[model samples]
Target: MNCYTLIKQKILAVITQLQSNGGLPADLKVDAITVEPPKSRDHGEMSTNVAMVLAKAVGQPPRVLAELFLTHIQEFDEVRTADIAGAGFINMRLHPSFWYAHLSTILKEKEAYGSSDIGQGHAMNVEYVSVNPTGPMHAGHGRVAIVGDAMAALMEKGGYDVTREYYINDGGAQAETLARSAYLRYLEALGQDIGEIPSGLYPGDYLKAVGESIAKNYGDAFKDQTEEEYLPFFETYAIDAMMDLIRDDLDLIGIQHDVFTSETAIVNEGAVEDVMDMLEEKGLIYTGVLDVPKGIEVDDWAAEPQLLFRSTQFGDDVDRVLKRTNGEWTYFAKDIAYHFDKFERGFDYQINVWGADHAGYIKRMLAAVKALSDDTVTLDIKTCQMVNLMQGGEPLKMSKRSGTFVTLRDVVEAVGKDVIRFVMLMRRNDAMLDFDFDKVKEQSKDNPVFYVQYAHARVYSVLRQAEAQIGQIDEVQLQNADFTCLNSDDEIGLIQVLASWPRCIEGAVIHREPHRIGGYLYELAGAFHALWNQGKEDTTLRFIVDDTKVTLARLALLKAVATIIASGLNLFGVEPLKEMR
Candidate 1:
């Protein structure tokens, strides 16, 4: 079904025939040969570098080898012509029938047209949105959430067994701080005149409900308990409430993790101790006084002897501390155990989506995975940069409700879930994104989400109009259309874009970049829009011509465009609009 792959196979067959006929060396390496689209449409539809790559090996000039290969390849019925370009690159033009048949394949496959079996069922664990369960998720968390979700969906489409996961940082000093903050609110709920929240405690109003809930359930039972007695209960209750808030924010953007792994649970199960023991056995763990990190002033830092991981052995700049001088395990220690647990669960690959602030942690984390898994598992870490929220070219301030930052819910509620998801993915994860409220909501071609959705809506409108003017044209009728009537350049150009969907999916999956799908969808939409506009000047170019055969063929083309759009949108978790209202 992949036209490019089909063409490449024919080119390879011709090269093999040439080798048999002594036109080229039988021992020449053909693995490096590649078939791709020509740089300019004027050159040809497809181009290959087989001749150029094999020329030096075969003891012949590139042009001479290219001519021989072209002579043999031109024998194929699908390739209308093959010509040698500069330096012996072979440019080819295929028969229009070759492109037109892809429309039938798209119509039959529908949303499944671009799906492939590249992963071969390898288990991939994608951990993202592991924001501390201390408060509502912010805009940065939203970006990672969508990116991770889309990546998981893309991997699944490419045949990877994907597991969406969230790692809760509920066993740290931050969790204790959250507990103390909730306890203050709990005192307030009991009618205690506790003045403004203490300097070190959380001051957000969102915790008031958690305080009230505990006051109602336990009554005066915990009113006079010591810090040691009440800290555990408050910490557990606060984490649950905060996690619920985080989940609600994710729900607004259609994200739900398959597993929520708790740091506290892993620590309580002695997993951290076990990992430390394993690393120690392998000589990766040691008692050491680490050098001061670069960029840190000596006067502002103090070095303490502690248990450290030999992260430098795996490309990190320095060894990392696994336990503090006070003997408590560091966050990195628990993370090492968590990743080891994932490997123990039998995942072949692991991916972590982190914020740009955590870029320095990548090497150490990868080192941990390598050491713990004995190089049996591969880990890929993606870092999402900051999102700058703007309106009318001015940066918007923090939300008054959240106090500290713009909550994910605020963005989703303001511009809607579909716009939020689309705009977030409009750029790659490593690039900074500007989310303009006015511009993204604008109903024009400048807005990518609207432009793509409008294309899909236009297809539905055309179908409705076609049915009303030429009797009902269902799937059967469209499939029976005389597709050979689609002979114009515009018609063939659209099919070419549609035919690249599978290739696009494979590329996106391999690169672990879902933003490519957004780019492809935009290009596909532009191509369809251009063809639709062509009808305005030429009456013959109109989709609904008087000829039933021509109209049916055009309808089939429209359906194929709509189907591919829907398929791409599904990977992004964005809904395809049937109508633009």
Candidate 2:
């Protein structure tokens, strides 16, 4: 059970009893009531502002209402003490029995301990890592791939029916450039002199393989053809090759999207025109002239009436252009149709993961979703900052245009996929991350992934020894262990942190921050390690003691710890360790 949720329910029950006795108005709304941990642990384990939230409605002073809650809350079996803090805040320190019970629940529920039934299978669509099919993926793409996949996994734990999507960006100018680059390599494959890769085209050495494959199939057919005659076939051939390489890169990180939507397919199906006509019918589309963006010079300006969307009415800085002066639909127009199609497929919520460079694009895209879905769907954009590769305490040089950037394959080969995925989530998506090669491999507490895995391994080691030293300690015996033996400070403190896992899941899902899970796991591991070291320092405090009852109690506690660590790692798509290497 979630500790905070339990506290909230207890407070609600007290309020209900008060209402029944006419101490509170029966019709008063208590939706604003909150019960969470205090900012400072010194205040109490959990705090609430129910009195302050209902003071005005109940026509009483907040302190007076706080007094009433204080009396009723003190009588709760879970609460050891309930006090009125500043501004009618209720701070509570729960009894040790409460934590012991929660620990028992952890052992009984196993992987289902932290999961909540709040979602009820709501549909969610998460789109990320939609890299263009012009070349192989670079190290920078790894961040989005991990973030999106982990986020989807996190939602699945909360019971959301999620779809992982990849939108192929093939219908763009870069696809043509890819065709041209591959054609040059194809000429070289056909024994023709095609020296010096051209400017404004891909210069990656990977394209040579695509050209050789084409030469083996079509032979000399495209070598003698004009750009117009060979461009289409070359585009299709190169994009297919690049997509294969991209899939290989994603496979290195264990990412497989449920759907791969093609921009070309969306355009070919007339979805864009249909969306535009609908928008026009809603009076959201109009032909208008826009001012030159502030940085552009007047000499280079082209001012004319263009088909625009009324994005400004929905909180965009300015109206967005739907069609260019030459009657070509802009990328924004196609995106609008894409989101509309997603909404029509019956997803209740949609999340788009974008790079830091797309920060300014969020407002207009959200405005489009609002206009098109009539505010029936929720669209959230998660902006992820860049990942800087570091080794020997210096930056790793990488550039796509120069074709010297580190490919995802290179990094995956260097440090296993688990390390890459773990390191990617060490920082918040909006914060710049530096992935130091030396630091991640260190087998110390300084490395978070190692520390967590080691804790699990440590627990596993003890559990196996306990089986030999004691007897078969199955789930039934664990559930019936003497929890009252667990009353020491460090023992109870460890249980307190274990109780916070459900709260952690709730907060992570609400804030859309999977990095919180990384932090939570690190904290949980630290707690387990601290208790283990305490046993080493003090003989009486050891987990495996001579007294059979106490030893069983401690082993059950370790089992709970291992279960939670496994649950969290499972959600991250990483295997829980039985031994550290």
Candidate 3:
């Protein structure tokens, strides 16, 4: 059902025939050639640049090669017209019969129309929302989480054995800080008048519940305990509570991770030491001093030797430190260990979805993966720009719950999970997005999620009307839908858009950008809405007509639209509404 792929195959057949008959060079490489939709449908339904790709290889001008291909493609039984555009591009208008036939293809394929076997079931690990288990997630964390979850879904649709993962930074100093922060709340829960929280510890009201829980369980048992006596139990308790809250928050927004990897477990199981040994065996680790960052003077600069990894050999700007002068493994060391664990678990591909603040950390992590896997496992790091929570055309103030920023749960609760998921993903992951409360809440075309959902609901409404007025259009009738009844330009144009779903998904998965699906769905909805508007003006253009055949044909098309939208919304983890309230 992918027109581009179908046309590309036919053009390849043409090239092969020409090669066989010696009309073109026998040794020409056709892999670089492409067939795509033209800038304007007025030019043609599809276009190809085969001549431009192969002209120089054959020692001929591109226009001459274009003419040769045009003459051959004009003989295609399905082609209505074939013309040469500027230089070497060939534009083609396929017969409406060609597009009409694919409508049945849509009904037959159903939700599997856009699916692909690109991944071939290879294991893929997508690690995202790896925030410290210290507090509730903020809007930025929510954006990353949604992007990662949706991207994983997209990959799964593309046939990758995808696993969504969350790496908890519980092994670091932040977890200890959280435990100490909870201890203060614990004392307060026991009727002690603890003053304002210390500056370095968490100050969120959300942690108050964690402290109260601890007090309720162990009333005053460790009130006077030292750091060594209370730190272990408190750290474990706080992280477990925070992680449970995080899990609940994720559930509130309809995201569920397949695996939750603990950073402390990685370190506690000697993964950090094992990862270092593997790197040392590969001669990637060394003892050296890092140069001071250029244009930035350090007040306490040192030239002493330290443990480092030769990350520069693998495209990083500079080598990275594995161990600090204090003899403690750096945070980067733990990250390398975590990725190594993913690799050892047999993930052929790993993707990390990080917030924009972590952009500078990408190269070193990639370098470590390359070094450890010897380029066997591929790693891709996607960064989601921060979400600007706007109200009345301006950024909102900090949240009272998180005490630092707007909590993800608060926004989801305010607008509902569907709105939060859709608006957060309304833009490219690497581009800044404005989640405007006033705009998304308004049920207008300006709201993309609403527009898309309305398109879906309209299709269902039309289907209901058609069934009641034109009699039941059963599954057999739809399977045998008379596509010739759909001869109007607008009818065919919408079908053309619908036919491109498989191509859209394949490209999205290949580029590692599922944001494209949002744009595609918007365009699909626009086309569908345009046709619905047309039907309103001309009764003959209506989906339900006196002629039972035309009514059934158009109803089949509407069903296809609903199916595609539902498939897309399922990937976004958002519900596709059959009726909007």
Candidate 4:
């Protein structure tokens, strides 16, 4: 069991004992009590501050209550000791055998070792990388895609039903720009010899392929058609082509969305007007003038009255526009409809992953979803910070208009999807990521992904070598082996790190952050490397000792490390390498 599980039992036992002794009030709530690891590892393997939090309610000194609870926790065999530390914190150091036993559990459960039921099978919808379907995905888009995918994977392991979604910006000014770019390319393909791309039109050569494909399919059929007639066809063709390119880019980076929701489809299905009507009926919609946004006021801000939603009443900074005076629905209107549709589809929670550039929009979007759903919906918007690409200690610049950007495909093709996925997930999503192309591809300990994967691969190498030299190893043989032979400090230390795997999963799932998994994997790898180095320094520390029984037991411990690394890698859809090549 994980430390959390064991400590939870201890906390519950102590709370029950206190209740029986009339130390706690009758009908006291115990739901808020939690037992987790302390911030400092030296303090304890597990920690609980429940006594401190409950002291005021129970009218008792925290240290006195902690001492009372310690007696009950100390009875458990797993808890070597329970003592009150500074500020009345209960620090519980688990028995050494308690930690060592997790190695056996890891081997027993294999890849399913750390799975938990925290989610209770709740449904969660995560939408990310909803970039406009007018061009290839850039590095920023890649970050969101990878983050969202990894989050979903982690949630699945934590027992949640998750739908990975992409909201296609297919009906907007951007789509029109893409259509115009394709038209220009089409003209050039027809021997018109268009000069430099104008400032408003896309300049990337990505559309050249789209233009050629259209020419091959339609030939001269579009030559005589009016702008109105051919524009729709070109827009559809170009958007489809762009989506195909985007899908390929995602495939290269190991991201596949379960749902692709199109904003254009919302309008096509008349859901936008339906949602507006629903909100109007709720008295949440009204026609009013908007105060000009501070620091970036539009010249037309005070020119006329615009249709507005009372977002400010629901915690937004200002009332947002539903439609412009030009009789077109605002982007916010379509987004409101999209989210309402998602709510209607029965997702309990929806998470939107956006680039840091959209930080200002979070309040309004959250406000819109709140107001539209009458506060029955939970909309979480995660803003991912920027990524600065570097190669050989220098900046790597990417510009779509300048045709100098590196596509996701380029990075994936260069480093392979597994390395790309692992490296991308090695940092917090909100923190700015420094992607060093050279370091990521390096086959050395400097690359965190390589280091973790090598640990797993090295374990496998040792296991395969044992099997070749001593025949197949099994659980009974390992359990019956001199597990006490694993008495070395390095071996015991490795087992302790493996014992934290289930705790790491719980933390990652609780915070909805997958970077914690990467951190745990790195530590586990460090433990494995330490054990391997110890083997180099002392022959008896190696996986294959002279006695076959002891060797098999050590092999079992190595298998536990491989099992955890594989599970962690699977949680991120990262392929654990067989060897560091």
Clashes of 4: 0
Model 3: worst 10 consecutive residues (lDDT sum):
467-476
Model 1 clashing-pair count? 0
lDDT of 3 by residue, 93-175 (tens): 99998887777888888888889999999999999998888888898899999999999999999999999999998976888
Which consecutive 10 residues in model 2 have the weakest lDDT in total? 396-405
Task: Give the runs in model 2 whose Cα sits over 4 Å from its true position.
Answer: 19-22, 25-29, 56-61, 399-402
Q: What is the lDDT of candidate 3?
A: 0.90
Cα lDDT over the full model 1: 0.91
Task: Sort all candidates by lDDT, best to worst.
Answer: 1, 3, 2, 4
Backbone clashes in each candidate structure, one number apiece? 0, 0, 0, 0
lDDT of 1 by residue, 1-581 (tens): 56777878988887787779876678878788887788788988889998889888988899998888888778878889889999999898989888877888898888989888998999999999999988998898999999999999999999999999999999989999999999988999999989987787777788999999999999878889998999999999999999999999999999999999999999999999999999999999888898777889999888777898999998888999998878899999999999999998888698899999999899999999988887889899999999999999999998877757898989998999999999999899999999999999898889999999999999999999998998887798887788998898878888899999998898898899999999999999999999999999988898899998999999999999999999999999999999988
Per-model lDDT: 0.91, 0.89, 0.90, 0.83
- For candidate 3, list the clashing residue pairs, or say none: none
- Residue-level lDDT of model 4, residues 425-484, one tens digit each, is 899999999888898878778899889988998988887888788888776776556567
lDDT of 2 by residue, 1-581 (tens): 78888889989998898899999998888898999879877898889999999999999999999999999889988889989999899999988888889998998899899996556799999999998998878777889888999989888877789999999988878889999999999988888898788889888889989889989998998877999999999998899899999999999899999999999899999999999999999999999999998999998988989999999989999999998777878989999999999999998699999888889889999999999999988998998898889997899777454386888888888888888888898789999999888888999999998999899999989999988888778888888899999998778878888899998998888888899988989999999999999878789888888998999899999999999989888777777899987
How high a TM-score does candidate 2 get? 0.96
Model 1 spans > 4 angstroms off: 15-32, 56-60
Model 4: lDDT of residue 340: 88
